[model samples]
Structure formats: structure tokens, C-alpha cells
Target: MSKYKCIIFDCDGVLVDSEPTSIQVLVDIANAYGANIDLDYGMKHFKGSFFVACKQMIADLTQRELPDDLEAIYRVRSFEAFEKKMEAVDGVRDVIGNLNLPFCVASSGPESKIKLNLGLAGLLPFFKGKIFSCYALKKWKPDPAVFLWAAKTMGFKPEECLVVEDSLSGVRAAKAGGFDVFGYTAHDPENELQTLATKTFSKMDDLLALINNEMA
Candidate 1:
């Protein structure tokens, strides 16, 4: 029925609405350090890795070097804040529950952070050991390592998996992994997703329908 036997999901903007939470945390931390950070600026540099983004934000806003231990503090605080306020992106649960194929989460976030956020969002039980983090790989998103690792760990071939992603970086990673990709445009338009996605959808039901047709 379906061309793909496995489904790989991106965690941040895709499965859970963690991006806003992450940005707010970073902004709050930056302000605490006497650097006022803007969301747009954050979106430009902080989409992939938390530390990388944090360091960049520190440098950009303060024009000062970060203490070696600053990121460690930020990490702990971010996780604490995230765990307190994380929610699934609307419709993620319904779509995931409706799917018949094997699926797993692969994220650019740290493994611990991913697990914590997923748990807070109540999606942890569904993923468990199936979660893979790019931070564990040699490189981050837009590099195929994380997705490849996830597919391999789940015993699925790259071509046998479909990646559901919401960000450009995630889409690029899925493409680089040689898998079919569906861009989720929950906040953007299909035209915006066209650059990377083979197909695009804003609604979970629409994506599920397409999956059904593809697998049929």
C-alpha cells in the first residue's frame, strides 16, 4: 500500500509547539544578561541547536564573549522552563494515532531536551526509545546524519521512510537523507514550503488523507 514503511517526524515545530517556548526562554535569558533579544533575530540564528543559538544570541546582543559556563546555566534553565510549558502542535496526536506505519521522532534538539519536552507535551510514551537527536550525530540538521541514524536505528531504509517536517532545516535534512518529505505549513503557506517539500499541508487530516492515499 504505502511506498514508505517508516515515518520519521521532526520534533520542534512539527510534533510539538516548542519553537515559541524556546524563543521566549532564550529572549528571557538574554534580557537577564542585559541583552534585549528580538524574536525575528532569534528565528534567524536559533532554529537548529540551542547552544549554538544561545552563544550567537549572546554575542549579537551583548557584543561580549559568553562565559564558558553561561551556556550550561542557560541549558538547565531552558529545560526547566520548557518542561513547565510544552504542548503538542494542534492535531499532531490525532494524525500520529491514525497512522498505521512505524514512526519515530528525530530532532535537532538535545536528546534530554527532546525527551523532556515530549514528556511534558504527553507525547513521550509514543516515542520513548524511538527518539533520535541530531546533537548525538556528527552534524546537525540540513545534514542527513540524524534522520539516517533514526531510520537505521528503527531498521528502516532511507527510501522506505517519509519525513514530516515544519522547518526549512528539517525539510533539508529529510531530503538529504533521501526520503520522501511532507512540509507542514501550520504557520506558513505551501509556496513557502515548496522550496524543500515534495508535498505540503497545513492540516493534519489533509496530511493523513494523503498518507492514506499513498499507502493504499
Candidate 2:
């Protein structure tokens, strides 16, 4: 039997190459509004968060609230960007195709954004009914509620689930839910999740190997 009964994937950076695009859109919007938010700032504060966290971060940094339509604008622009450039993480498709256990996507993104990006990357079918969004759950990462809910709904105990995540907040959430987490470090050169994740890998092929080794 596999070591894990289920695998939970963080959608943006772990499953799809959408982080750079999404971060760029955030930076562009902030800069456009003269908030002076840059890529470094975004990577530090925005990588693992939802819209409410983002709004709070912006307010904390700029001392001003984001426009009410900011999410609407971001959705349109980011969807356009995803349509033109979104792709699944390297080797992720093959990993999913060959996986022996149940898997699902649990992300901080809204359901619409998750569907759009996954569809654009041609990964929608793999996780059609298995997608869990914090927006719909009303419990964001670092809270653990979403992951706990996913585990229950998927009929897996927390210890029987493994989380593949790319953000510190995500790792924290998975850990909080009592699940082992592998931190995907391709986009996190600074190793933010190194101390929290059970293990860290920079490539999907390596992640596959790690998973296999665990099962062995």
C-alpha cells in the first residue's frame, strides 16, 4: 500500500506555473496605483495568501485600502495571462497520471481562479470534483480548517494525507492539520518552507521519487 492514502496539492505554484504570473499581476496592480509594491515584496508577503490576506498586507504596507474592484480587475487580467502562458508544473502531469492514491487540490485561491488556471493548463480533469478552495470554505491557510475539511471529505485521516505545497503558510496549514508536507522549492529559492516541511524538493521528478521512496 502507498504510504499516503491521499495527496493534497497546492494549486498555484505546486501544480501549475501560475505563481509568477499571479505575482506579476499583483505587482503591476500595486505599482499602477502608486503603492510601489515590487516582486520582492510580493514574494515575501503574497505568495501563500488569499485576497483578504493580500488586502491586509496592502493596507499595512501602503496605509490605504485596495479598491473594491481590485479582485475583479485581477481576475480578468490574471485569467488573460493564464490563457496565454499558464502550464502545469514540469513533470506534474506525469506524476498525477501515475499516482496510486487519491489526490486533490486544496488552494488559497478562489474556485473560479482555480478552475480557470487548471483548465488553462489542461489539468482540470485530474481534480474536477476534488478541488477545495478557501474562499468557499471561509477558512484560509495558516488556519488549517480547509485542509482538515478536505481530509474529512476525502475520507482520509490527517496522518494518512500528504500535502505538496510551495508556500510557508501552506506548509504551516498542512502541519497544523497533522499531515506530512513536502515543500516544493522550485520557486522558493530562499527556502522559506525548509524548516517547516517534512522534506523539500526542487523538481517534480524528485518529488515523485520521494513519494515512491516513502511508499517503499
Candidate 3:
């Protein structure tokens, strides 16, 4: 059987199908400001990155100073898009329902955003009081703090938890914190997650088996 005692989920792409919606909003807003990026470019470079990171990239792309409210505009627009378009990752509800282990979310999003997205996806109840946000720590992914905090709060060592992540930053953070992470590759266009994660799978339906050591 898999030795994991707890699961740490990344909220955006893993739990709620919000990455594309979120990134699309960023691309649209950035393009309006002359970033000139397409959806594919946003998905590749911005997925899992902090807003500041994406903002700096947009500034670099436009070769000019951006509005101070870039993030504010993004939050408002992205949440609006999410309200209309966000859904739970396919088969995630079933996995969360059937999995017989402890689990929680650790995301780079603000707690309000995480809760809003999860609530929209009908996943809020499963994660109530168990959500950890990097914003809460003023730390972003590739820093390991969020995952470390989640594992500790969930009462598991890093080695005893499996982090389900769909972003490069999330995978890197989990690994750096001494946790095994499964890269969820459903939206991956470049097949990058497989190279960095302990194991990579594309569907949530397969997760129960993967966690239970039923998949070889």
C-alpha cells in the first residue's frame, strides 16, 4: 500500500478547474496592456506563478510600467470568470469522497479566492478549515512554506503526505519540502510536470488507485 497518510491538494488546477479561467483572464488583461500573449503562452509561463511574478512578466513583455491596479483588475475579472466557468476537476469529487485518508488544500491563492473557487466547485465543505494559503504566509510556491505548513497543520510529516499539484511551482515546492507529489497533467501542454514530479497522472479518477498503491 502507499505509505502516505495525508494528501495536500493544490487548489487551482487540481481541486477546482480554475487555472485556464484564471490564466485566460490574466492574458486578456495583460494583452489589453500590451503583453500581447496568447492563452498558450499564459498557460506555459504563468501557471502556478505568483501574481507578482506574472506582473513582472507582463511588464517585461510590454517593456513599460504597468498600472498599480493590475492585480486588482485581475482579481475582479478572474473571479467573475470563475463564477461563470469554474468547475471541479473531473473525477475529483469522487476521489475526495472515497479516499479514506486525511487531506487539505495548500494553494498560492488568497484564502478568499481559494474558498470562493472551492465553494463554486462544490468542494468547500470537504476542505473547511483545512485550507492553507501561501498568501497567509506571504510566501509563494517554489518556496516550500505552504506545503510545509499544510503538512504540519494536517499532523503529518512531509514524507507521509502526497501533494497533488498541476503547476511547476507547486511540484518544485512540494519536492523541496521533502514531499512526494503527483503531477496532475490534464492541462499541461508541454509535459513538464512529469519531469519534475515523483509520479505524474492526468486524470483524477486514477488518483484513488494511485494513492492506494493499486496502480503499477
Can you give the lDDT of residue 16 in candidate 3? 91
Off by over 4 Å in 3: 214-216
How well is each residue in 58-114 modelled by candidate 3, as lDDT tens digits?
Answer: 989989898898888899999899998889989999999998989999999999999
Relative to the true structure, candidate 1 reaches a TM of 0.88
The residue-by-residue lDDT of candidate 2 on 76-191, one tens digit each, is 99888888899999999999998988999999999989998899899999998999999987999998988888889999999999999999999999999899999999888788
- Candidate achieving higher TM-score, 2 or 3: 3
Model 2, which residues run further than 4 Å from truth? Answer: none
Tens-digit per-residue lDDT, 42-81, candidate 1: 6555665547756776777787776788767777887887
lDDT of each: 0.80, 0.88, 0.92
Q: List all candidate RMSDs to the true structure.
A: 2.3, 1.4, 1.5
Q: Could you tell me every candidate's TM-score relative to the true structure?
A: 0.88, 0.95, 0.97
Local distance difference test, candidate 1: 0.80
True-vs-predicted CA distance for residue 54, candidate 3, Å: 0.4
TM-score of 2: 0.95
Q: Of 1 and 3, which scores higher on lDDT?
A: 3
- Top model number, lDDT: 3
